[model samples]
Target: MNMLEVFVSSLEEFQPDLVVLSGLHMMEGQTKEMRQKRLLEAVASISDIPMGVPVHLELASMTDPELMSAIIHQQVFPLVNSVGLNEQELLFLTQAASGPHASLASWNGVPDVGVVSDIVFWILKEHGRTPGKASDLTRIHFHTLAYHLLVTVDGYWANQVAAVAAGARVAGTQACATQTIDASRVFLKAPLEFATSKMEEASTVSLNPHEPVSEWHRDGVTFHYTPVLVCKDPLRTVGLGDAISAEGLLYSEIYPH
Candidate 1:
């Protein structure tokens, strides 16, 4: 889109904490499908460091959800350790007595709107053996939602909630603003723990430490990229430089796309 060059060039400049790659709908000349694919490739290819360029696609309508989920599972999640969602956002779509799917069935053509965080609390309360157990059913519903060809607005929120709940956390790992559940935060420890548990239950192959550093080949860009990801700021950069530096720069990338 018009901002791509601006954004990409900025990546070469500010090199901020994390780079999220949404924004393809703004491009004027291409079809939506083409734009999404091009954006996906550019984002995925940004790595010069071993496993450093993990890409995240927001759970948006524009992409093929199954393929996107497959990509996230295969190319991004292992490299990343977190995905955050606001509790209110989840409540907007799902709730105790009904989810968007049920609403659609009832409506036949029109859809009902619900509060995200509010509904999340009710859904968890109703489905779980206990509050803590609710996220499990939420996660199942999410994984299934990702595979659906058509999505209800509620379904979209459900997938996001489920996917993240599947290993997702509250933004910055604090208590849900209204619900009081331990929200997934910006922290790595909780997400890592959740991911490990999910794999164990599903018997899926777990992500291994990324390929060795020396295996990567750089093509003359000066920015340093490392094997693992974590958010970075000026202070963190100083700490990183102390521990790992190449060509006079300390480098780390955040994997949450």
Candidate 2:
């Protein structure tokens, strides 16, 4: 079987409560605002799934405080109840909302294309240039190091509540299009109690903008859907399909039944 068949089978059988559009692993965007907008719109368009629920996402960036806030205000506020960010991300988020890069990037020698929250902090401390309470973006249920937290299906994240526990914290079985994390961000394993006995057919994999992948595979199978998952041969990149085999069979005690 192929990777597409595997993922589709999983989705068809599990029927997860919510879906997470795994950002393809790459980062060369215009800005956080633009990227946030694209991400939000894409997630809003998934066909079969509940729209209202908290979602867990894995990220890796250098410093993009404003960009992160853009995601919160533009996409999350309405669709998501809360979000999860690492300590550094939280710091930048506070600064970015206020129009200052916040410089949260240098907190741990980690630098990327993210905003700097400290810029706002310094400005507020010294210049006081903030026109108004531009930094009143604290209306969120933020969790630190959510990546680490999601590594296990313990009681802390037993319910898949995005950043908290409620009920539906389910993630789509699709591969992330442009997912970049400072470290590894893996969703905990749910024993494969439920399995797709057999796949019927392979579906075409279509990736939206701002989405890229490193390796697309399924159950140890590699996907090769040209023009859909990868770049030109010389400038090749992988899609979510390559992350697993077409038949992503696993030995989990509890499947998504």
Candidate 3:
């Protein structure tokens, strides 16, 4: 906690292009009062980030609804420009926020793209960047075994196709524990055709292998989807989400640059 406070206080000296916060779930065992104090400090430090320098919050498995709610409603979520999470974290956020499909306890398999898309859309519309609001969130990079979804407010982000593809590619290499992908071991598991949302009138998007990346626009947001080359035999699954998020961010281009 002391180290974090010192680093955050020195942001002007570092002048970073991006800031990412992860592993808050590490505080699970702390007493409520202690956790509250640290979180309050964290929120205060994050608020000190200079305007226009994008921040990304990466979420992990957190079972406590109270902690999740505090991060979502009171402080953290409102200040970050982007977020990265898997299906479980996404469902938990929806559940905590009382948003769409809040009743689902867990997913049976790779979640349906439409359901994921709907939830991602709901998050941005309900909690993300809005006129006169403090929330700066405009981008969500959601990863699953089957696919990766990069959703962003249209004007704030650019080059979605490359970013999504880079994330999907890293999932294979990282899981297989190889710097270069082994073609015989990796196979695509994502659906070729998927609906944009769960709505009755939602549009269906079909993947073209030649292009691989499929994109759609809804309301004021744009979604980019790419099928992951899943590893048939995995050496390790740990850190896959982090690797995916990091690679995606590396390729991501902030608009108006």
The candidate that achieves the highest lDDT relative to the unseen native structure: 3
**lDDT per residue (tens digit) for residues 73-140 in model 3:** 87788888899999999999889888888888899777989889889998888788866666788999
Could you arrange the candidates by TM-score from highest to lowest? 3, 2, 1
- Global local distance difference test of model 3: 0.88
lDDT of 2 by residue, 91-172 (tens): 6555656534443344543221122222212322222212343221111222221111111211112222222221011112
How well does candidate 3 match the true structure, expressed as C-alpha RMSD? 1.5
Q: Candidate 3 clash total?
A: 0
Error of 1 at 227 (Å): 35
Please write out the lDDT profile of model 1 over residues 199-248, one tens digit for every residue: 11311122233521111111210110111222221122222211211111
**TM-score of every candidate relative to the true structure:** 0.27, 0.33, 0.95
Evaluated at residue 25, the lDDT of candidate 3 is 80
Q: What lDDT does candidate 1 reach at residue 206?
A: 27
Q: Which segments of model 3 are wrong by more than 4 Å?
A: none
| Steric collisions counted per model | 14, 53, 0
- Candidate 1 residue runs with Cα over 4 Å from true position: 24-40, 48-58, 61-81, 85-257
lDDT of 2 at 30: 59
Q: In model 2, where do residues sit more than 4 Å from their true spots?
A: 1-13, 18-37, 46-48, 51-54, 99-257
